[model samples]
Target: MPPAVRERISAVTQKGVTLKDVAAAAQVSRATAARALNSYGYVGGETARRVLEAADRLGYRGNRIAEALRRGQLPLVGFVPGDIQNPFFARIAHDLEVELRKQRHNLLIASSEEDVEQEKELLDSLRSLSIRGFIVAPASATDNRHIAELAVGNVPLVLVDRAVKDVQCDSVVVDNEGGAREAVDYLVANGHRRIALLRDDSRIFTAQERLAGYQNSLREHGIALDESLVSISRSTVEHAVEATIRQFSRRDRPTALFTVDSLMTQGALLALRSMGLSIPHDVSLVGFDDFNLATFTDPQITVVAQPISEIGPLAAKLLLDRLAGNRPAIRNIRFPTRLVVRGSVLHPRKS
Candidate 1:
């Protein structure tokens, strides 16, 4: 090649590889190069290969924004979890990323930290990226005007492990109420009436449902609701420890304890140990979500186990369907949770 030609090619490589540059390298028209790169229209076999090779050599990445403008969609999906650091959310994010990757799309994750305002801001910021759709676990089910607004704007949205009352979008959640009820019923059957609940923020939909389940179980069994036995805390081990300590510190200590999530369960374990309470002997324990630590304790912890593996894959499938212009009725899939009974609960001593 001539010095001028070589210099121009170097400039193109240094700046950025454009469609024109790829076309020039492949010795084809811009239109042909585009058709070949995008796999649209009729591209000749040899010419298509040549264009692809040139694109690869040039490290040519197409302008996503420009392509999105043309096609009215971007190859990006947003995931806003209640707390990304939480293992539950982390597992879902992994599944979502794996599922989206199969379709040549990317996942952009942002944590709401269980703040409604932060959730709204995340949605807005992601929207600015022209995200194709979103999978969000709304921070507060009631305070979700932003989520509703997104759905109203016809964005492909899916709610996972949580829901807003008025948002008619796809959702994948577990049967929190039934699961909690089962746990409490088991404790009651074991001759424990003074049960304590270590729960998360009431604004969260899961926490609300679980609380209802707890109350309903107590009422059915003719046990009076003890408001003092319920301790609300942020969904973290540290917060749960403090709440657990407070609950057991009172003179009228609970004979049994139920935690809302795995993090809280771990917290309860730490708190109980510090207070010289032994599992099954001192205080019977059951948690809502099972984790790795559940079985590792001296006496394995019993738990209400949600079908966590299914949640993210199902959510991704729903969002992808929406993005593909499938206008089926909005789906709300709530998977049943199982009560995994272990050595955590036993008959409580007379309280």
Candidate 2:
């Protein structure tokens, strides 16, 4: 550790060191010392070094929350996710917290549990706590009135994973459409014509985009769109399992299944297992959003992997830029997805 941080740690019981003392020791005004400490305003290099040395010798430690309040700002950043149960969102949240901590800011996380009203209430509660900005994955694309209000109020906000239709703001999202298309295209190349899609409700933006990509790929490959092969509004594992079972029980069952999200993918696997259907023997499978459990399955699942590691850091950088007074036009950054082919997908068996 540097001398300043080391001295701070050593001075556990000493409490008299202050900015005034540091300024006096450095032979500079309190304003100059403050600027040097915070790196807010322009200060001469030598002057900053001297002030830092004085602070280190005196063991002067600043209270970040108190300083932020004095400057009419909050040192807290808010992160609101639609559901924390999803490992994808949890990973994003964890990465975001790590990035925020590096910038000397505290992260406050709240879950909406995939409820629109609950999301609004959580936003309201976080706003009341004087959050500096927000990073959100919207629960419903159509019902984003609260998010719109945040933009209107000039609060720095960044959308992650999901983007609302009318609520324009900075966003960092994966290429859901392209990923879905790639997965479906891979299935088609494996000689699977009858491909079934299992997805969440269209209220969520990611689900909608993935569904569009699935449909578009089928159309591009000269496969007539079959509405009966698509399963929508399957939000939970139980719902997805039921939908998958119902679809497979049909006289004209699909040869392959493409799930739009992790939960639905797990459910589809369970449903296939319960029906005694073998992977790529009875039905090939492709899923969106790679997770740890995907690799541990009997035959590792093939999935469209989003850049989870980059998403959170990119979102944090956007918010931090806005906080630093960079008011450029809103930007929508869509990261590309990759298809990791494992042992799951294979050529369809002849009838």
Candidate 3:
């Protein structure tokens, strides 16, 4: 190669590949390369193919930040969950990313750790980056001032899994009350009179609904509500285990247990194992959020399964539609839950 040509090539490589380099390599003008790569104006099929091949060979990537700025918008979306450690939230983030990518948008994920202040900080940081939209599961139901402000600002927002009260925006959630009711009703029908409810604190909307459903089911079955049997404010596995042990240590122990979430269910199982009790043979069990571990458990836990796969895609679609200028009234979509009957529950044993 000529020394001048070699120096030009080295300069292009050292400065990082650009659209101009791609256009030169393809023997096309810079505007033609830009139209082909961005799919903006019409370009001949042969020209477009050559431009794309040259771009690939030169490792040329368009500057998304500059393009977004030119359009006066960001090519980014955000998903703020309380805890990404939970399998359900992990699945939501994954599915939402898949959907967002289909629309040529990127997903920015952040965990709030179920802290109100942390969630607020995350939202502020994401907003500073010019995030186009957000799919948030409020960290605390009571403290959603930031979320409310987003709605008031007419930001494209969707609340998933858990929603804040009185914030009118698109939301996707499961039928928590109905699912909890069905789980308790199934236990009651199995002849379990003394049933215990294990769940997190009522500061979360889902927990409050599940607790309400448990109480409603007991009342419907003509069983007196026992406050002691309902364990509230338990978030960690240790807290759940302690609550379970305390309940089972009582003189009139529960014959069956209903846990409102996956962590609590696992904690209850651990507590039972520690006590050397067998499923159904000693105390029956039912739980919410069916997971892979549930099917692998000794008795195969019966659970209320949320449609996690559907929730993420639906929420993304709602936000995308809003961004596309399809502004109907705000919608709150509630997905149905199913009760999978496994071998976890049995008839109450005679004392």
Candidate 4:
């Protein structure tokens, strides 16, 4: 054939070599060719290979429908987090974006605003997008069934910060229990015998874990756990501040407090000021996860610090690894935390 004629023939073959053409070329039925292409059960390996080779030789480009039915659409990895406005979650999103950019894969980001129904809705949307992998920070109210459904779908999922109970999956988390213990230990060592706990919502995994750590350390030091001194907030800075003042007005106020989060730290500071309490004089406070404003407080806040910038990259890398088919059994990665002592904590003063 002339060069131009040969080119035309090739072009025509490319255009015509759909499942119908592959079936005819391989001396098989169209349904069999489709089954082979889609990796469906009962298609003999030898037959599948022959059909594939024939399709390749014909210069065929598979249709979108065939690709979707066979292997799903273009690849995507998702990140679903609660409270996107929180600085912690924002940092996570930024790092995940950078990491995914390095791999040339797309990201789908969603927020649940700490609502259970919103979380479920976001998950449903991501599933519809055919995302094969996910990095999720479940809402405080998320249920086990919500997590189990993802597992059942065989999605490569990684939990960040908070994890679902009894659901096995890859996770990137901080040493919440250990960090809290360190914070409390520091306070006790400084002679804070009457320590209070300013807790975030009990429904949150981190909050509950940190509370356990606080209680454990108190018990270890022979300090009786005072339920009256433990205040639970809805994870809002305002609510925490109000609760702190209420606790402080009592005749028997705690000499020191271990706050659950940066936002809660703000509330504690406000309460201290409102009640004319001076840091380390009347009450001392320790915070979890250093915040930008920690240094600006009247007495700079002491904090248990996690490597926030590193957390994002680590979680993104785990999701990328799953997308690459490593599929090693679920991994649990815990990062270490450090205690940053500042002017906020001190020895208990004589009454």
Candidate 5:
């Protein structure tokens, strides 16, 4: 390290640098130094620059909590997603962090783990931090009073990948119902009557919409809804494996399996393999939210592909717009999903 830099750091550690010292160095008043450092009231361009330089030189580390309290908000945007381990949310997080940082704001991410109580708790905790805003993929579609309260309280918030019933706010999601319907329609078109669905909890908005699509598609084709063929599991591989096993243990097993998310799809693949079932022969498969493993699998999985790359960046933009005080009206953008066909399906007789 350079000599001056080392000396400045040592001075801070030994005696602690004060705002007065920084003000004296910059030839400004203490009030001006505070303003420049905390970013509350405006300061002149040249004076603000000098004050920041002097603060850096003296290694003056202000109390962040105190500053946030004074300013009524922090330079941070909290993100609460359904699951952090899911790559769909991971990609969105990366984009959110990048975009927030561009505006001199930091990202604070907390996963709700697909639990309504946890989602409520996380939002409460983040609000206590005086977070400038939030971007969330809520855990429940119906039980979302915590999220609704935030919107009603005029908190700057954006919902991504899901929207609640009464919480009106800016959102960025996809046509989950349409995508799911298409996947099932394709399966039915290929002459498959005994198709099964592996899905997430009913509370989640995406799961609800996708489930509707599944039911609607079957009904449109004059096929009766067999409640036995639908299995519910958490959005995790282990839970999905268990669900898949239970679903297939019946003597009249499903001819095809449609999994809602990539994690569940991966679990289904494992469970099927463990049972000595072969793809496109023993049981054809389709999944939602394509992942790296989707294309790599043998007879690469057919999937309802959401515009993953578009979702995160678009959500970030919407949240940023809200933070920028440009709220003419609430914007709710829902992108369309497409079916990405591969070699994962076969005729009913083959199954």
Candidate 6:
């Protein structure tokens, strides 16, 4: 052969081997080689090796389209929160994103602004994007019907923080009842007989659980459950503060107030300060869920601390597990809570 012709043959053989040549060399049907190369159909173990080797030696270029079709879909995880601005939800999202990144999966975050309609709309939007899995903190007042649809659709989902009872799915949550009970128990032990319970509205699962815990503790300790001293406020700090003042302004005011959630804690503190009531001395205080400013308050607020970091990572792992084809029914994994006793909760002063 001429030198130029020889070089052209070498180039075709080495750098530009086609599928026809690979199929011929493999001594199998073109269909078989195509399947083995594109990862479409199953080939016998020995046949698969022969096809792969022939393609490798011939430098056969793969069909990118076929490869994409075989690979199926991109890995995606959705995270929907009641409000991304809320510190608790923000922390959860941060942890979830970090863990999901390690798995080479992308995260899609959305906020519902605590509106039921908004939550349903966002969920639909995420579904439209073909999200592989979900980590959701549902809105407090969300209608169960909307969430039920998501559950019945068999979307791999993990509920974090708050969850609806009928919606069966994997969940990671704090021990709300125990934490609230412990907060009130600590106050009662500190000689606070006239204690008040100010908590978030029961529209949320967590709020309801915490309230039940508070009520149980007070009733269990032989303290007459006074409805007048108990108030349920919205999630806003201002509403909590207003509720606190209203409870405190009564003729027989509570000596210690137990509020749930970090925002509510701030509200309670602000209410006390505005009323010129000193912490521990004038009125003892205990709140649930500690935050950055908890320790820096006038007299550091004692709190029942939820494991925010743990919940986020665990919820992510659960959602990923569901995505991985491990269907062990559904789980409700509840994490333990810790009571951090600080200066804010103290022994009531002698009248």
Please provide TM-scores, in order, for all candidate models, with all chains considered together.
Answer: 0.83, 0.79, 0.80, 0.77, 0.84, 0.77
Where in model 2 is the C-alpha error above 4 Å? 1-73
- Rank by TM-score, descending? 5, 1, 3, 2, 4, 6
Clashes of each: 0, 0, 0, 0, 0, 0
lDDT of 4 by residue, 185-211 (tens): 999999988898988767678887899
Clash pairs, model 5 backbone: none
Candidate 1 contains a number of clashing pairs equal to 0
Q: Write the per-residue lDDT of candidate 2 for residues 1-351, one digit (tens) a residue.
A: 357545554554266777877777777899999999997899999999989988887777887776765564767889999888888988999999999889888888899888889999999988876788999999998988899999888889999999888887999998999999999999999999999999887889998899989999999999998999988745667888999999999988999999988988888999999999999788999999998889999899999999899999999999999888899899999999999999998898887
Look at candidate 3 and give me any clashing residue pairs.
Answer: none
Better of 1 and 6 by TM-score: 1
Instruction: List candidate 1 segments past 4 Å from native.
Output: 1-73
TM-score top scorer: 5
State residue 285's C-alpha deviation in candidate 3, in Å: 0.6
lDDT of 1 at 34: 95
Candidate whose lDDT is highest = 1
- Cα deviation in Å at residue 128, candidate 3? 1.1
Candidate 1 vs candidate 6: which has greater lDDT? Answer: 1
| Cα TM-score of candidate 3 | 0.80
lDDT at 258, model 1: 94
Residue 259 of model 6: what lDDT? 83
Q: What's model 2's TM-score? A: 0.79
The lDDT for every candidate, in the order shown, is: 0.92, 0.89, 0.89, 0.82, 0.89, 0.82
Query: Of the candidates numbered 3 and 6, which has the greater lDDT value?
Result: 3
What shift in Å separates residue 347 of candidate 4 from its native position after superposition? 1.0
The TM-score between candidate 6 and the true structure equals 0.77
Candidate 1 Cα deviation (angstroms), residue 129: 1.0
lDDT of 2: 0.89
